[model samples]
Target: MIHIRFSDNNYGGEIDLSGTPGDLRSIRQSIIKLLQAQDVQVCIPANEVKPAPYDSCLNSLVIRKSDCSVKVMVAGSSLKIEGTPEKLKVFADWFNFGDSTESGYHNHFDYYEGNEWVDPASVSLIISCKYRGTK
Candidate 1:
């Protein structure tokens, strides 16, 4: 079984797939496509302090997923995908982020690969689909 583990402070979950290698490949491709199409400057929300004052902002990230879809954030090529199972998947760990001549705010990831950053507030949608091979 190929398992994708997801976690956050409020929740932790996993999705297991028994499909073939092509399924995994398509999923990875979908994630890449979606992220590439999103804005690169995703703003991390600052925690609200009514009666308290904190100096640092929170490293908050929310992940959304369905049975065949995934919505997540990645900084440059530095994403959180692991290929431990060998039979499952593998993703690169690093890519450029802040080498642009624009706002100099730094980018976390590329949407498809070798592409510019998109608006930070953009949310990506990836539909998990099965690719059928014609005989």
Candidate 2:
């Protein structure tokens, strides 16, 4: 499964996902579509747009890949989300609040190479985000 975590100072949240490849991909696509559909604007260094009303932003994302599963930690407003590798990838790609680019978000697809559950073919992912206010 994939997981997401959002944290700030004293608050946090998480989301978990478990399903087949198609389901996982669909979930990820939804998140991306939602962000694109929103009226909010993202401020990218190259293409800086005006901030939106909600000011939703993606702070950080941590992706952990394992032999049998994936974990995603998103630290934003103390919110967390979990799901499969495919789903997590979708969230990572579309994770933009008021900014077009995030600070410390990355994907580690070979984290479980030397461990006991190590499987060269197995793949997973994790994500984390940090927000400002309450959800």
Who wins the lDDT comparison? 2
Best by TM-score: 2
Off by over 4 Å in 2: 1-16, 39-90, 93-135
lDDT against the true structure, per candidate, is 0.26, 0.33
Candidate 2 global CA lDDT score:
0.33
- State how far residue 14 of model 2 sits from its true place (Å): 8.5
| Per-residue accuracy of model 2 over 7-65 as CA lDDT, tens digit each | 22332222322222333344455545434453222221111122232233343223332
Per-model TM-score, in order, reads 0.23, 0.24
Model 2: residue 56 alpha-carbon error in angstroms: 30
Q: Write the per-residue lDDT of candidate 1 for residues 23-131, one digit (tens) a residue.
A: 3344444444434554322222222222112122223222222222122333332122211221111121121122222221212321343322222222231222212
